[model samples]
Target: MRIPFIFIFCLLFSAGKAQEFAISNYDVLWNSQSKNSSESMPVGGGDIGLNVWVEDGDLLFYISRSGLFDENNTLLKVGRVRLRFPQNKLKEGFKQRLNLADGACHISGAQSGLQSDVRIWVDVHKAVIHIDIDHSKATNAQLFFEHWRFEDRATKKKENNQNSWKWAPQGDVKTYADEVGFENGSLYFYHQNKKQTVFDVVVKQQGLESIKDSLFNPLDGRIFGGFLYAKGFVNAGIEEGNYINTPFKAYELKTAKPSKRQQVLIALQTGQHLSPEKLKSETQKLALNSASSAKKDFKNNQRWWASFWNKSYIQIPKTADTTAYQVARNYNLYRYMLACNAYGDYPTKFNGGLFTFDPVFTDSTATFTPDFRNWGGGTHTAQNQRLVYWPMLKAGDADLMKPQFDFYQSILGNAEWRSKFYWGHNGASFTEQIENFGLPNPAEYGWKRPESYDKGMEYNAWLEYEWDTVLEFCQMILDARDYQNFDVKPYLPLIKSSLRFFDEHYQYLAKKRGSKALTADGKLVIYPGSAAETYKMTYNASSTVAALKTVLQNFLQLPNELLNADEKAQWQGMLTRIPEISYRDIDGKTTISPATVWERINNVETPQLYPVFPWKIFGLQKPGLDTAINTYKFDPDALRFRDSKGWKQDNIWAARLGLTDEAVKYTFAKLKNSERRFPAFWGPGFDWTPDHNWGGSGMIGLQEMLLQDVDDKILLFPAWPKDIDVRFKLHAPQQTVVEAEVKNGKANIINVWPESRRKDIIIK
Candidate 1:
């Protein structure tokens, strides 16, 4: 049966209208003065990012680019640019707005009755940033490059606290930077890493010097450089650092004549093993090319952002309650931040994600360089890091997931070598807090460990026995495959190896215990396991158990051609040996247990809800939904630890369990206006300002509230509040999308891809 033409047209028209409405409704507006870098607005394209702010009556923006790791493994900023007009024209009447529809920042203000308007944006097709200024009257302007780390300095011990293996501090750490100078009326700077990197030092410190050659190194010979060009400006004298005596050099450019309009361009270039001359040449070419095609590139940049916004959106109706508006506004704001680093070489960092500002603003005692953050550089905590990327599937940002997937795959050899070298195992063993070179972070591993400590375990109590979070990432890849039908053949080895490590490692532990280490029920005895840093010395930890079971089951469901018969049989046999999820009775109500047995509690995490989220073993359409609900309601730890902060899963689990009131309460808390200038720039809570994981988890919770899927069945408004009206377009499995609107207790399905998938829709 063929569909009628008018009906099809109506469906398309409604979908377009919803997208247009979402784009027009949510844009950040600021009319107050920005006191510091923390109050800055963000703008970016490709792999470049800028935090544009007006500080002390001057326009200042910090330049940051993805994959610009220095020799010490710190992610460094490119430089800072300060633009000043005659008589400080940006002091009052300042209004800066982030136009989300075009990915640009517009700043306008009047000083002494002189109107000035500035537009800042990054070229989507080129490695350049353009700042266009137009004034009502001709005026002289000056642009300067402000750099703090101008000389080679020894890293102080206080700054080394965040690095891996802080106890075994090496001799004075030397920092390096690009040589900056003025040439042909332009300021040029560049930094190139040495042939050797911190990876070699870390490997030797961990007693792996003999096998260092076998490990992967991701930082050798990396180079980054850029040139700043401003039309009609001549080179001015440089100024040494005066603030805090942090030795810095300033390159000044003064306008040759008073002009109504002036433009500045900063072109950047980065890669591995590029010569200094080549970098300079390329940067110059980029600046010239961008200057010649500015108009065309601006239009293309706008189009790119428009397409990004069109991919997916969520909008709530106007309400007198400010919280409701903030929930919808912050959702879009956080998503925009994610899009800034969409093409990064590394996955967005959980701490600050390229938008980090001065450290003194965050902690009074912690006065350090702009590169400093809570967690060490090049170290990824799997638990916190996983939250940063989980929501991309629902947001229809599948392409943005590649950097993370590639990161794990890049380090596969090192992970496998470590496992085999230590325990003669055939699978890779990824640690909880992992380094880019594929091993436990040295500082977190603890240098002064006792002889009885396990070689593969982290010395920190919070990270010990926390090896299951990688499965969540594996699950992400599997889910992405289902949502987009993308090729997973490259990732199959990674998924299988991760599961294989758990099976082999547990069996190895059982053999060490005794000849009959297997339980009477013939299940693997997972001892000395920690349930998400909370339960110490536990057996059959529920989080790890659920991850193992869920991943293995999902793996088997894939096409047989993707997995050989022998591999299939091995996984099937291993699944049965895994322990059943444990449960307990709390006040006469059955609830999920953190683990079967544990010596003591350590952290504040609620691991019992693992079965409810990340693994859909007992939620919504799954069996034992009532039992999971009882656990959520009755569990003491779950109640005590519930909050919206760094890496918290309470809001997500509540929505997954179909608890409308609980979900709304937590979602509102998660999406509330952050103290920062940008509404979505949340937290230094357990992490850093503009916490990526905090925002990422909040995004997941909101998405779950609107739509959830179990196999082929899609449930709409599962945990959404009836009083709150919403329109959203979210992705589901089998290349399907669910666009729907809910108002006045009525749900309307706008469209579903492939048409045939609509048969499985279930309104909850």
Candidate 2:
């Protein structure tokens, strides 16, 4: 049958429109007062972020920047800003909407017989914040900088059992800000770390003082601050705190004239080896540069966001059941949050990620400052942290993944030095909970450890044998190499060193246990190991074995240019020494075992199904599928704790195993809107509210449900519901994109890049 070219073009255009995931007017709105900053809307670009909200008829936003670590190792906020206008103007008809496509927040309301509109956006190309205000009538306004941590306070360690206080000492923690002054109608505040940062303290405490010179200190000589400029406003002196005698500083500025339109700009700068005066001058120059190119920067910001949306999208057809819509909406919203910190020097933190509100809002009893969080600052838990980056593979967010890669590479030297100094090995020993300086987080290492405890092992039981999660991140790099075809040479060291640690560390342990450590079959025994904090003091942990085997295999597959013959041989040799995955019988069915032997279960995690996920050794169209499914069905921890929460793998494992009903059920629970105003602002489940790992794990599951790639084969609708209509564009290996649509239980392959790749499509 011959079809008209015009008809074909029109059909293609319609399909494209159907795939668009744009948010229309009033789709995301907040009309009433926000209870606290936790309910605030997130807005940012580049490395700057702001948690903006309207509280008690006043505009409030907490400003945060990446790489702004204080002396105490806390990722401190720049400061808070509060803007006040006429009270009557904000009394009625108030609404706030996040314009996803344009990457801006719009708040409008009618007050004092006048209508006002305020638009806020962060500059994509520069470290600046732009705010434009328009009103029907001339009005007066006040802008204030509310800083709570202005004075040096003695460290009063809380007795709470949280991880933040694990290694906290009783001493004065110097405030980051050295000065807060208002001059020439502009406000300036700066934070300069002391000569001694937490890096030095951690080194001395962990007995690494001998190798201190080799360590990489990211906080040393780092200075970060901002300049606030209001052209038509005059300085109104400073107030100390909200109360009469509170020790804090709040600088104020007031409008000098009545005007219907106003614009404010905040210019930020940060870097190592920078002086306070230099930072101040640089910020002033940035403010001027922002003013001169305001219009162009605004257009550029919009274009960046537009291109981001155009890269990929997942749009569900309007359904009578709102749950489906909420799931799709929350997925997009969480992705938006991840984009806010696109160029952070460090990865977007798994804890709050620059959107943390005041602590008292989450709990009244824990009345701490804004800087308080359950997890310590500058601490990255590899297991929970890997979740934050895995979804970027399918999302096709390659540019955003650079920060995370750079983080590991930047600390590679220090990590390698620590391993060599501790155990005389030639690999990087990155711990489960690591400091930014490439050592174990001080508190997680434990201050009251027994004299006989191994210095290399964390004092905590859960993190003792947790070194394999980094393999998943290495897999991400390999997957990226296939997707983007970029130079993997830079990341080769990270992959090799990560695997080297496991191989060499195990051999060191075998030596300690004598030749008997190797069973009669000659397979290395991994003892005193933990299966993801669940099975402690275990031997042959399934997750560890799978990680080593899978990563080594992938390591051997890298290009010859990236891997020398000797390196490849080393990886292949290690693979042979790794123990086979353990298995057991449950009710006459064979299933994967968590480990060969263990002392006791310390936590609730399903390491048995790990081979099904991050390792991908078992699942749909893979070997040992039945065993993986049986393990999922019978594993006690998997059955008991199969819920959508922090670090849970039930949804992901279910999807990979092609359990459609179970996958859909868990995915819905994982992606549905929480009680918070922001649909994607999820729980304090096992972490903090707006738990990033929870959202990240949910994203990974949702993407896996839609598409699962094994080598060259693509499995569509592997765990997706037939009743739900969906349109999506997801990336796969080999730089291929699978654009698909499912309508009325019929799957349609809209487009597959490099058409030859479509030959391997398996529509489930």
Candidate 3:
């Protein structure tokens, strides 16, 4: 592999000239000093720069970045969650402060009956924290978070935390013999397989023996008890979490480590142990065994990440904003965080994200949620969430992409189950809503207005058309993982159900265009459900058209080796009647969603791009390529829309349309806009923290615009604009990797790495 140019690391940033966090707004944002103490520095939320909120009573906190080192310290920062037993509610004999640091950031508020089963930890070099929280908590446990920046008294300036000394906190969580540990630099947190808890607590601090007591808040019942300047967060469950187990996961790629190879051995040894306290004798032996290589490993860790940043990165060449670099880095870093926090089994698709940080409501800025939120999955949200995975797919992050595929698989079943109910047969019918569990949730999660998705509207049944889009992604996961022992056949039932629904549902809409003719003889048009999402709408939506086309095409592409002849022909037949997309001229503007006229659109972009984005039905393929392009261009909002003068949906659709300039504009728009956050992670104008949806899309938009390959042809600057030049490389399916640089509306090839065995660039 060629060495890269930029540096990528787990950064700790602070607004007060200390290391802490990032947010969209770059201006002078302020947060409350924690009631716990005055010594804490405010940490900006990692990516979404979300507004902070301390809820119930999770006032205790200290925010510290994993893998960060203080400039002068040889040891890593090890922040602790030192909570003293409440004096008033305590026994007189002995009030002890529980203070051990090496456990993963877990939520175990000492509930007597509840086992501290959940443990959330950042995977090696990954920012994604794997969560193992209990779904049974009736009273949400309180969380304590703190962020501190070291100011060197001698330099008389805030100390940069990039070089912090790394060490495990001496907390009881680390005392478990089965507690996981890095050999030298790996980031995976493992517990003894036979351990009692699902997670281990990880303690981190900047390694200062003691900071001023002022840093902590004097014990108070309020969320802002800490005097230390820190951020806090609270999660309101998903839109449908009550139906399924509360699923939680974090996203991030491991930081290039100091001693990855060596850590493998150390980790293996750690896996062998059960508890540190019980095996103190063995612990000392292992520490001594690993001491000699510490220095060498640390240096290598920095260099590895530095090499990664050198390749495939976005640098703001020239921006008027003073915090341009911060914003630029924030966007990229958050993408890194997304990758780092991403999981292997489930990408946590719409189940929501891992490091969702915010500040205590009292403090205007910083915070982190110890527990995962309830269920929620949005139609408009899927693409943005999928964006984070685009780069990951090529970065050799196959495991990270699993959750995304699992989500699709789960939904396929959900669509099929709904279809079976609605169609009165073995097929798929999509409802407007779904949760982490693979089931339709109209019974709960109904819109307050209660229309389509919830069965009040006429066209809700057509929502299943969107499932075809999910099928295409399933194909991607199939290719990414080589499909090796993974049994996707089980999911084919859903695919069959979807095709069955579409083939039987579609009707000739060409005969009914507007007015009484729209209803024709008023036969109460049956079948083709609406594309869902809106209240009441028409049958056979452009979205359904795009999706039906996608589904038909996907079945045809499945290798003959993988499918039976009968199944293949059935899919081919469904491709024939693919519905026509409807468009109207609102002063010559062609838009794609359910309504063609192009209004303010309470919903975001048109579903027509289902073929363009998550679905790959129309590319430089068959013919609609130009039509698709025109439709995108004709709509004013296709690339840019002024929602109260603020831009939305532009960042995503631009990339889908291959409009690199538009994509970049939307990207920097979120960055440069005054109302936007300074750190530039991008959020809706309303809140400072990032909506993970948009944050994920930023990565996908940029990736799609830069490089695209269907089967054989790799298009350079396909939709890239003349103003911006991009340099990057991506890994394609079947082991082929593509790297290049584009400038002056042209691309220059850099490199391509092909896995020894892989196939199908663009299938015919």
lDDT of each: 0.82, 0.80, 0.36
Best prediction by lDDT: 1
Q: Better model by lDDT, 2 or 3?
A: 2
TM-score of 1: 0.94
Candidate closer to the true structure by TM-score (higher is better), 1 or 3:
1
- lDDT, candidate 1, at 450: 86
Tens-place lDDT per residue, model 1, 1-764, is 13346433533555565643556567777787688787888888777889888876688898988878777777788888888887546766888888988888998887887788899998877789999999988988888898876877666766654444344455667667568888677878898988767787778756677888778887788889898888889998897664332456788898999999988899998888899888888898888788888889999998888778766788886662679778888888888888887777888888888788877777776677766777766788888888889999999777778778878888888888877877888788888878887888877787778898777667887788778888998998888887756578889989988888887888888888788757898888888798988898899999989998989888988888898888889899989999999999999989999999998988888889988888888889888999999988989988888888777888999999999898888888988899878888888888887788989988999999999998779999999877778888888887777788887768989877657888999988
Q: Supply candidate 3's per-residue lDDT for 616.
A: 55
lDDT by residue (158-244, candidate 2, tens digit) is 512122334456355544445788968788888888888778878887898987887899888888888998878999998866621
Pitting candidate 1 against candidate 3, the one with the higher lDDT is 1
Per-residue CA lDDT of candidate 3, range 307-387, in tens?
333323444333324443443455555545454333332353322233322223212322322211122211123434445
